[model samples]
Target: MITAFLHGFLLALGLILPLGVQNVFIFNQGATQPRLIRAVPAVLTATLCDMLLILLAVLGVSLIVLQVVWLKTLLFGAGLVFLLYMGWSIWRSPAGVSQAERPEPFSPRKQIAFAASVSLLNPHAIMDTIGVIGTSSLQYDSPDKWVFTASCILVSFIWFVGLAVCGRLIGRFDGSGRWLLWINRLSAVIIWGVAAYMGWQLLASA
Candidate 1:
């Protein structure tokens, strides 16, 4: 049981630790409007979505997902577009814009919508949940699958909450405009990198 839990934890980390669209967006929100108090809702929504997908994967729906080549391709393409658009938006935003320039507080509905969009529209999330995580779960014993799924869900919740809270803490430092600028830049780069990798995979599979 201990070994199973450790394996599950590592697998979950492997899926979630990458700098994907969701992570980048969360980080941006943290840096830009850390005080909005909506970050918790956003993170919680994302974690819940992740748990749902993981559940689907564990139930063997992932096999169906893998068979739909065109659907996967379309999702990947959409993700690429989203990443590029976000990257452009971040790059074009004023580097020194103060928190005063930030938008009004995000409502609960808006936070949930943002989280759902990030998860649903991201091809990598699908692949990670439906392909990688699903495949890993199959390697475990039947009794251990539940343990694995639980660990993955826990990891999602912990990571997102920790990231959101840490971002708020970091954003509290005054005169950190340059640091924020670099984070935006880094987020943009990570988005592009993931897109490029996905494109390469799509081409390679063709």
Candidate 2:
């Protein structure tokens, strides 16, 4: 049990450590929002989404869903398009116009929806939770499997919350417009990079 739990934690941390689309958006929200509290909606939405996916994966649902070639292709295409759009938006956003300074704040509803999209649309995330976490669980017995699943779920919550907190800390020192502009620029690149990679994989599979 202990071995399975530790393995789950270590594996999950490794998978999530990369600066992916979901992490970037969460971190951006934390840095751009008026206060750290304002980023909670996105954080919660993302955590919950991961939780759901992880649960389904552990129960062997992903093995069935992933068999549909059409569905997988459609999801990858949609995810690619959305990533491109989001990347462009981040790159082109006005200067010195974070949520704190802008007259129009990003509503919680929109944030939650986008957070879900970011979590669900990305095939990479699904594969990690399902492909990696789910497959990993098959090696364990019932008790160990549940312990492993719980450990993985716990890591997701901890990582998301800690990421947001780190963003908030960075925001404190980056009062100048230069810092945010560069961050946005880098974020745009990372997002676009993911989109391109996903697109390539889709085409290759086709």
How do all models score by TM-score?
0.81, 0.92
How far out, in Å, is residue 104 in model 2? 7.0
Q: How accurate locally is residue 111 in candidate 2, as Cα lDDT from 0 to 100?
A: 77
- Top of the candidates by lDDT: 2
Worst 10 residues of 2 by lDDT: 97-106
Clashing pairs in 1: none
Tens digit of per-residue lDDT, candidate 2, span 1-206: 89999999999999999989999988877766668899899999999999899999999997689789999999999999998988887788665645354322247997797789889999999988888899989899989999999999899899999988987787667766556667777878999999999999999999
How many angstroms is residue 182 displaced in model 1 relative to the true structure, after the best TM-score fit?
A: 2.2
TM value for model 2: 0.92
Please list all clashing residue pairs in model 2, or write none if there are none.
none
Tens digits of lDDT, candidate 1, 117-187: 77876766876787778888887876788888899899999888778776766666735366677777787
- Name model 1 segments beyond 4 Å from true: 97-114, 139-143, 203-206
On TM-score, the leading prediction is 2
